[model samples]
Target: MITGASSGIGRVAAMQLAERGWDVAVVGRNPGRTRDVAAAVSGTAFVADYNSLAEVRALATALLERYPRIDVLANNAGGLVGRRGRSVDGHEQTLQHNHLAPFLLTNLLLPRLVASDARVVNTASLANRGGTIRLDNLDGTGRAYLGGFPAYCNAKLATVLFTRELAKRSPVTAYSFHPGFVSTSFGHNSAFVRWGLSLLASRQISAEQGAQPLVQLASVDSLGAASGTYFDGLYPNGATARRAQDDNLAAQLWDTTARLVGLTDG
Candidate 1:
């Protein structure tokens, strides 16, 4: 099951996996595009806006009803917000969309994933190197959010922390990855970021090239590495951010996020 499958790495990864004979569940915010991708891949399509926790819950319920066993869940639906906006759920938009929403959906489907022994692949970023995890100020209630790019970086740092924490607490394997700097419509909300992406075309990789790590992690039969390992492309990364490597911080973030999403039993 792949979120954000209507475009970019998720879309290409869905197609690639379908070509490999895997049944892909193509999920996205756009109904028409998501359905089109699903049709192309001969797979299922689900629509959900991560800005709404209710929508995230509905997506989880629908997914559980549709698939008996979800082999791989790619938490790939997220992007940068132009400002410190708020979701319908009353949290920071970037944090909610990128981290909280996926956190909720994954936990909601935890039972089925554990039963199926599924692997979870979170799409983090190299920008995580610039991020800091503040359990006390995760929502960026004040001037802490900085802006779109900084918030995006912090949210991605949360992604890695969540993956490691999940691996420790759950039976299923979990991994996070940096997909390089992919050329996509990822920073549509931030003009500065978009300009940066365009100006640095030499640093950007194709969506297909970026999807390789996700496809590789999702398609492997036996991932011999540790469950919570972070990947830099196809290989394990030794230089994860210091904050992301903090086990205590990861646990605290997991517990705090669980509460924020209204999950009582984390």
Candidate 2:
């Protein structure tokens, strides 16, 4: 199952996996495009807007009902912004969509994931270098945002932390990987970030290239033995920042996230 499979890296990755005879399920926020992608890959389509936590729950229930066993759950649906916003659940939009939404969905599908011994892949970012992880401010409710870059970084950092936490708490393998600066609609919502991303066009990678690590992490037999490791490309040699190295912080974030999402026994 791949979230954000309607376009970009998710689309490419789903198509590639489908070609390998995997029964891919494409999850997207856009119905038409999602159906288009699913049709292209001969896979199923699921639509859910991560901006609403209720929709995330609905998505979880639907996935569970349809797929009795999910072999791979890729939490690839995310975005960046130049401004701070809130979701239907009233949390910081970036935090909610990029981190919280996937977090909740994973927990909801835990029983199925464990039963199948699934691999959970997260599309993280190198921008997580200076990202902050504050136990007192998980949603950035009390902080001020100069721009969305910091918020995006924080969310990505949270993704890596959550990967580690999940690996420790569950039997399934979980990994967070940075796809480099892939040229996509990731920051199209912000004129400033869009222009900034355009300036780096010379350095950005294609969506197919960006999806390579995800494909490797999802299907490669070697990676099956590894869990909670962060990958930048073909290898797990890349490193995260100081804050991301905190086990205590990961534990706190996991507990806080469980409480926020109303999970009974997180």
> Which candidate achieves the best TM-score against the true structure?
1
- lDDT (0 to 1) per candidate: 0.91, 0.89
The sequence of per-residue lDDT tens digits that candidate 1 reaches over residues 18-130 is: 99999999999999999999999999999999999999999999999999999999999998998778899999999999999999999999999999999999999888888
Pairs clashing within candidate 1: none
Clashes of each: 0, 0
TM-score to true structure, per model: 0.96, 0.95
Candidate 2 lDDT over residue span 1-266, tens digit each: 99999999999999999999999999999999999999999999999999999999999999999998999999999988568878888888889889999999999999999999899999998878869988778777767675677788899999999998999999999999999889888888777677778888899999999999999899886764468988887778467878787999999999988888778564
Number of the top-ranking candidate, with lDDT as the measure: 1
lDDT of 2: 0.89
True-structure lDDT of candidate 1: 0.91
